[model samples]
Structure formats: structure tokens, C-alpha cells
Target: MSDLVDQLVAGALDRVTAWPDGALARSSPPPRSVLPGSFNPLHDGHLNLARVAEEMTGATVAFEISVTNVDKPPLAVGDVRTRLAQFAGRARVELTRAPTFVEKSRLLPGVTFVVGADTAERLVAARYYGDEARMIAALRDMADRGCRFLVAVRADGAGRVRSLADVAIPQGFARLFTPIPESRFRTDASSSAIRAGRRAAP
Candidate 1:
């Protein structure tokens, strides 16, 4: 991690210092919540999500990178640093390496854990955590600690956002924000698209 992002994550970690697990003093208290994403190349859409998340919760955003996902393929360790550079000084955010969504979910008690609609849907997949019940229970535990959820609408092929109203958010998971129609930014860029060495950007 870049020294800058390390500082940022440290700052964000300070917010939950009171948790029994202890806090990193260097971290800042995230004003709103975190909008966790792979942030591969950190595209405009991700930036828009951060802005919208701030508007909704009145807090700074943090970008989370999953380490477990990185080992699966072409993404290098330096990718986080590269993506972090894209947002430097533009926002009071930092990059973190979270091995699992559940582990990251515990980082900031009471903060909103932002995710894409597809990810929100996958939270209940049977393969997650080897059982669906444990996943649900874990989310509930996070909620009990003040952690909430925010989901962005998934963009359809036409670049239109699908409705998130019917998405099944587990009980106690409060919706802190939704993607504004105006905040939509379309891109064909994704990790899969980028791995092909094409014009992929996420």
C-alpha cells in the first residue's frame, strides 16, 4: 500500500476506536460510510458513488480492495496503489485490503457498507461462507454493531439502472443511500474486461 493510502485507512479506522477490537489511531472517522469495491483502475462510476454516498450520509468515503480476489488472477499487488493514486486529495478516503466482505464489514461499526447491486444479490449465495445462514447471521451481527448497507443500482445494457426497491436486504440492514439517477455513469470496463488488455476500466 502507498504511504498515503495507509494513512487514509488508518484515519478511517480511528472512527471505531471504541470497539472492543481496538482502533488504529491514525485512521479518520468516516463521515458517511465506506463504498467498498475492487476499484480496479478506479473508474468514474466509483468516484460518482463516493460523491453520492457523501451527499447521503454526510461522511467521507473509503475504498476497499479485496485481497482474496486479487490472488485469483492478473491483478498485481501494486494495483491498489495505482487505483489509490487516482483519488488522491480529491476526497478524504483511503484504500484497504479486506480479505472478505464479512471481515471488512466489521471494520467500521455503524457505518454503511456500500456495494453494487450484483454484489448485494450475491451476499446470500449458498457458496458464501459455506452456508447462507451464517452469512445472514453475520450481517445481522454487523447491523447490531451499527453497520448498515447501501446498494447502487445495477446498470442494464442500455445504461439504465435497475430498480433496487425489490432487492432483498436482510432484516436490520438500513438503506443509507441509493444511486441517484443523475449520478449514473456507464462503463463497459470491469476486471474481466481489463484482464483482456483491452480498454477495460472499473
Candidate 2:
């Protein structure tokens, strides 16, 4: 990792260690809630989610940019630095490359994990891991440790969103925010779109 990226991650780790439940030794204190993503280039949706999460929970939001996407190639360390700069001190957002879901879970034991509808569907679909129940169980365990999840709704091609009512939120979520319908910000820029440099990804 580049020095700057390392600094950002270290700074984020410091903050995480300072939360009410943050005890570095035990790895038990639920750090501030985390919104982990690749963020090839931070976008408005991310900013919106951070703002909305703070509005809904009144807690600092941690923007975790993990380097562990099996589907996509990893981003350069400098890219991580640039993105961190983009989010510095915005509603208690912290940027870091988590590298693994387990690492992320361990780092933010008592915080909420933000994701989208597609990830949520995979969390329960046996086809993805052949043990949907195991995935659910793990997430529940994290919640039991004071960690939970906040799943946001992503827009479809027609500017529609999957309602929160459509998904089953397992027990133990620290807090749950309603899915933001497509009517609020009908964005078309996604991370993929940003990477492709075609139109823009929402």
C-alpha cells in the first residue's frame, strides 16, 4: 500500500478503536457502522448513503473501500488515496481497503454493514455459496455482537428500486433504514459505468 493510503487506513483504524465499543485488544467493540464498497471512484450514491445513514442513526459512517472483490480487478493504492481524500471528514466517514469480508466483520464487530439489493439476495441464495443459512447465521452473529446491516436500494434501468419490504432482514440489525426509492435520486452512474468511462455509473 502507498504511504498515503496506509495513513488513511491507520487513521480510520484509530477512529474505529475509539468508538464506545472499540477495544482494539478484544476486537469486540462494535466500531461505527461501515459502508464497504470498491468505490473505484466515489460517487453521489455513496455520498447519499453516508448522509442518509447519519440522518437515520446519528452515528459516524465509515466508508470502507475493500480490495477484495472476486469479480473485479483490484484498484491501485493511489486510487484508494484519491478516494479517501474525496471523503475526508465527511459525516465521520473513514476510507480503508478491508481486503476481506471476515476482516471487515472483525474490524467493525458492533457496526452496521451497508450493502445493496444484489448482495442481499446473494446473502440468502444457496446457489452463491451452497449455504445460504450459514451466511445468514454469520450475519446474525455479527448483529448479536452489536453489528448489523443497512441495505440500500439500487436503481434498475427504468429508475425503479427494490422495496425494503421485498427483502427479509434477519434479526439483530442495530438499525434498519427504509430503502430509498428511485424517485429520490434517479442516478444512472454505477461503479462499472465509471470504470468503463462510457456514460456514467450511478
Model 2 agreement with the true structure over 1-202: per-residue lDDT tens digits: 4344444444434222221232122132354667777675778887787777776668867666654355766555566556556655453333334554545665566667766765565555555545767766655655566655666776555766654556666564325334545444334567777678755545
What is the TM-score of candidate 2?
0.67
Query: Runs in model 1 with CA error above 4 Å?
Result: 1-26, 68-77, 156-162, 170-202
Indicate the residue-level lDDT of 30 in model 2.
50
What is every candidate's alpha-carbon RMSD to the true fold?
A: 6.7, 6.1
Off by over 4 Å in 2: 1-31, 89-102, 157-160, 168-188, 197-202
TM-score of each: 0.67, 0.67
The residue-level lDDT of candidate 1 at 89 comes to: 52
Model 1, CA-based lDDT: 0.56
